[model samples]
Target chain A: MTRVHDMGGRFGDGPVDPSPEPVFKEDWHARALAVTLAAGALGQWNLDTSRHARERLSPKDYARFSYYEKWISALADLLEENGVVTRDELMAGQGAGPSPLSGRKLRADAVAGALARGGPADRPVDSAPKFAPGDVVRTRRPARNAFVAGGHTRLPSYAAGAVGRILHHHGAHVLPDANAHGRGESPEHLYTVVFDAAELWGAPERAGDEVTCDLWQSYLEPA
Target chain B: MPHDHHDHDHAHAVLPPDPALRVKAIETILTQKGLIDPAALDEIIDTYENRIGPKNGALVVARAWTDPAFRAALLEDATAVVAELGFYGRQGEHIVAVENTPEQHNMVVCTLCSCYPWPLLGIPPGWYKSDAYRARAVREPRKVLAEFGVTLPGDTRVRVWDSTAELRYLVIPMRPEGTDGLNEDDLIPWVTRDSMIGTGLPGRPE
Candidate 1:
């Protein structure tokens, strides 16, 4: 469950490089962004599903590919998976037949409008929020089944099993774990959980430090 | 179309680098399939670069520094307040403005992935998306901030916002000292991208 992508607190990561460059380094990077967004606008998969497709890659491949390269790969995978584009079409860089979803094109003029009207994950739920602001809570220890399954999860590895206090109740939002799997939007209360550095990383690392995370109700319990 | 002239030397010389060629090939294929409009691609790129960038965020910070009412509105309902100024979309659909004061500072990071407020801040810088930052930010934020040349007072509390959900964070960096005479327009230049992200402070006027 804890993949290389989830490297929150564990060390050995090299020093942060402060190189300044334009958003797209190469031409393909821009194309990668465009193609991914275009494909995504067709409504074949949600954002979480797109993210999971990239996370599902082998660690070796994930490490080797640049950020846009990962997106391009994921786009290709999703195209084939959704029957929008075929594997042979991707390999040959040409369509073998008419696109399956030819009618679902996002026009050039609609780009800005579509992005501005983002798909908000918030959904109405009947149950009231369990925790309020200032309530002490502890992060649930990540279950072995979910971790070993290697499915999409919003709970970062570093925050799991950590104790925190609720800073705010963010109302009900779609659970990303379920959304990624095509499960219904099992909406839940989202809260801003504030953890002391001492609680998360232990002593010497303490001192005037706190980490706040937007956690779902399922990830927390009363401390 | 160019692939037809496949003479070995011409192929080697005329072909772009691997990534460029790969992207070109994909673009051409998608265009042929009628999946993506080239004009739309250009529009998206233009929107991010020219229309929506850190300047929009700088303006918001500048206004917040000068107008208490706007600041209150931002802290209370960031999404609506920012949209009032015409900066709302995509990653910025839900935003919460966290203020940095004399006693406390705020920083933001997406531990799981590169989640940034594109409508306000444009694309995130390379360092924000780096593995080093993702790991160290929540663990040793002081050290990371120091690396960004932002050494705070020993007693100043550092609050790191890990963006794990839909709500994005924008750090309303503390106004620098000695800028009492500067108007809102003049103060816009002081608000840097890193300042909004809480990695560094706004530039103090000399």
Candidate 2:
């Protein structure tokens, strides 16, 4: 579904302030990240699910929250949905005690190695790639009101219906649009498509500039 | 729905609007629930806040500048080359090194979300994740680069890598001239975080 997080070519954004920022602004920002990662080790949800939870936030809340705040809200929702904790427990600051899932926790010692060998997204597919490098392709424009329930997708709105040439074939990877809804990982051929800035924004001054997006085969159609 | 949110406080205090207080409450509850170990949480926090960061990526860039074989290997297979140097982890399962030269400038952005090379560069900079950068970086990169005090030559081409998927990119920024005499140790300090991300250039020899 189209959300505020799908911001790409839309205008009226504020000017960027290029300044060095601390890794964590407050003590809680660190906690938010760590708790999210630690709980994520539970294998209750995947990265795309956590991302869709944030995007599902009301535009008002999404705009109001700081970066880490967004993570906190999403983690809270994911925790509740996965039956790891209850809203009452959160309000009470203590659960009905730990559940059986509690025993499967990430220990302090494994943190370094676990993060180093991150979960790989490239899964092997049974079928051959549909398209290869140098193939021109177009992205599908979704029908209106498509994302009724589990409308999790990685295709940003700006690139929808845009035609571009593929520069590289990245092999089979998980398709997030399907995976976000508890749908099985539908591995698809992934390619990096190069679009001219002028093609995306229609600005004459952007003639010499180009933009590239890593897209899954499911999003593309032969042009 | 009243039960779904802690809005409208009872005789008890509702979760504070302060995010710190809210996160505190969630953590306490999650810990008590046994889903999160306090020690594990500490380790994760310590690692990002202190251990992993741009210095790791800077080391790779310095090696590419000093060693031709590493540069070729980095361009050929960044994920394997970086892992060889012990710099492989989350958000960096796959990496493609894009080189910047006088004829072409490259910048990286995740317009949809902040999908950065965290293992290589640590947490993304504030601007890289800001709404403005997410919207304008892909739409008008030259303009965005200009705001960052980067003025490319009129003939130079601009390339914006919007990595919305799992394949992360590290920009192999062109090494500044007159630094040929410097060793990799001397070159390490010249590579800034933004330089590796392609929003800026390497520091000139001093």
Alpha carbon lDDT of residue B156, candidate 2?
87
Candidate 2 per-residue lDDT, tens place, A157-217, comes to 8888888999999889988877776777878899999987777778734577888989888
Model 1 chain A lDDT-worst window of ten: A142-151
Write one digit per residue (lDDT tens) for candidate 1, span B38-88.
898888887776788899999999999999999999999999999988888
DockQ (CA atoms), all models: 0.37, 0.57
Candidate 2 A-chain TM-score: 0.94
Residue A12's C-alpha lDDT in candidate 2? 94
Indicate the docking level reached by candidate 2.
Answer: medium
Score candidate 2 by TM-score against the native. Answer: 0.94
> Candidate 1 residues A34-143, lDDT tens each?
77887788788998888877776567656776777667766666666677765556566676655656577788889989878877777888999999999999887772
Pairs with backbone N, CA or C atoms under 3 Å apart (clashes), candidate 1: none
In model 1 chain B, the worst 10-residue window by lDDT is B1-10
